[model samples]
Target: MKAGLFIPCYVDQFYPQVAIATLQLLEKLGVEVVYPPNQTCCGQPMANSGFQHLTKGCDELFVKNFANLDYIICPSGSCTLHIKEHLHHDRHEATATAIRSNIYELTEFMTDILKVEKLDASFPHKVSMHQSCHGQRGLKISQMSELVAEPFSKPGKLLQMVKGIELVELSRPDECCGFGGSFCVFEEAVSAKMGKDRVADHINHGAEFITSADMSCLMHMEGILKRQKSKVQVKHIAEILNASL
Candidate 1:
């Protein structure tokens, strides 16, 4: 299938490796992936901060870059959710709608659309899974702990397919890492505390690394883990899925 890769602004700038891993993973699965050289932000930061009405430029650019692709797959759940929910251009509502319908976060695209049951990757480490709020709750890639329903995770399922990887359990599974974009800046103390607690949970449970689909959340927790000089490292799920060892 023809797919366009939507790398979020932060991932493009800070976590380029995650984007690379995502690209490699898709190619390994035999997808014809395309990268729009002029693609920019999904206008999520502005929209989340209560300025969605001003995201017309971003929306238009997104529609222009991705309207023709069979699928627009992104590694970021937060950005994908933003486009799916807030992307709109008054002059081209149909284009906006088409974009939204075709866009999907990486894990969802792999599990739901690709229906991948196995992977040729290996990681011999004990790891914990961090379900980013946008991917887990918004995209419903997995069942939330609060819901009275069956438990399943696309990311977790994919991880299980990899060789020599042990998935650890967290005390409060599916809890937010408190990286709500600007929420971290506005509520510094609370955000830091939440990150610290989340990191501690993974560390206490013997996790060598914490993995999640959202690099934003891992970036937030990485800051806290670094400040504490913790041995635990944060990794994006794409990196693990695409790993050769």
Candidate 2:
């Protein structure tokens, strides 16, 4: 099946390696992938800042670039969740709806759409999985703590296939990293403190690296890890999945 790659603005700017790994992993899985270079932010920043009106242009532009694709796959849970719930166009409401239904976060697409059972990638490291809020709560990539059901993790499942990789357990599996988009900019102290707490869990658990489906969450924790002069590194799930491929 054909898929369109939707790289979020922060990822496109700061952590482009995650986007490249995502593309490589999907192509390695034998699926045709296309990237819309003209695509920009999905208006998530604007919406999160309470200026969703400014996202109309962004909505229209997204539709123009990704309409008619078999699936729109993004490496970011927050951006994928934004399009799934908020994307709209006054002139092309039907197209907007179709794109929303077709879009999938990277791990969800792998486990649900691709039904990925295995991978050729491997990473020999003590890695901790930081279940980002959007991926956990919004996308349901993992079972929530408050829920009474069988626990599952789509990303964790994929990671299990990687050779020599050890998935470390966290004290709090689904806590927010305090990188609520513009929330970091508004409440810098609270954001940093939350980030430190989140990073501490991984470091204290002997994690050499922290991985997440959402790069924004990783970026926040990366700052904290660096400031504390910690040896732990942050990586997107796609990067580890694409490793050795």
Candidate 3:
């Protein structure tokens, strides 16, 4: 099936390698992926900042770029959740609905749609998994620890398929890293503290690196880790999954 790649603005500008890894991973699986030349932000930053009404242009651009695709896959759960829940156009409600239904976060697409049971990738390192809030709660990719249900994770499942990668367990598995887009800017003290705490958890658990599908969260944690002179590095899950050896 044909798929459209929706690389978030921050990812496109700041972390292009994640986008590149995502593209390479999908193509390796023999999927026909299209990168829309006119695509931009999913308007999530503005919407999460309480300016959702001002996202009309972004919404229209999204719909225009992706309406015809069978699936619109993004490496970010935050952006995909925003589009799934808030992408609405008064005059083009049908298109908006279509786009929303077609959007899938990367791991979700890989596990749920592609049914990828194993990978040819390998990473010989001890790593910790950061379950991004959006990927866990918004997408229901795994059971939230507080939910009293059997725990599972699509991203974690994919990670298990990689050779020589030891997935370390965290004390608190799915806590927010405090990089809630604009939440970090408005609540600087709390954001930094939360980031520090998150990094500490991974480091304490013997993680050589922290991996997650959301670069925003990883970026926040990476800044704190660097300041603390920690050896743990941050990587997008796509990078690990797409690794050749």
Q: State the lDDT of candidate 1 residue by residue for 1-245, as single tens digits.
A: 99999999899999999999999999999999999999999899888889988888998899889988899999999999999988888898998898889999999999989999889999999999999999987999999888889999999999999899999999998888988999999999999999988888999999999999999999999999999998899999999999995
Q: lDDT values of the candidates?
A: 0.93, 0.94, 0.94
lDDT for residue 222 in candidate 1, whole number 0-100: 98
- The Cα RMSD in angstroms, rounded to one decimal, for candidate 2 relative to the true structure is 0.8
Residue-level lDDT of model 2, residues 1-245, one tens digit each, is: 99999999989998889989999999999889999889998999999999999888899999999999999999999999999999999999999999999999999999999999989998999999999888889999999988899999999999999999999999998888999999999999999989888898898899999999999999999988888888899999999999993
Each candidate structure's count of clashing pairs: 1, 0, 0
After superposition on all C-alphas, the RMSD of every candidate to the true structure, in Å, is 0.8, 0.8, 0.7
By summed lDDT, the worst window of 10 consecutive residues in model 1 runs over 45-54
Instruction: List candidate 2 segments past 4 Å from native.
Output: none
Q: After superposition, how far is residue 32 of candidate 2 from its true place, in Å?
A: 0.6
Candidate with more favorable, higher lDDT: 1 or 2: 2
Clashing pairs in 3: none
Clashing pairs in 2: none
At residue 38, candidate 2 shows an lDDT of: 100
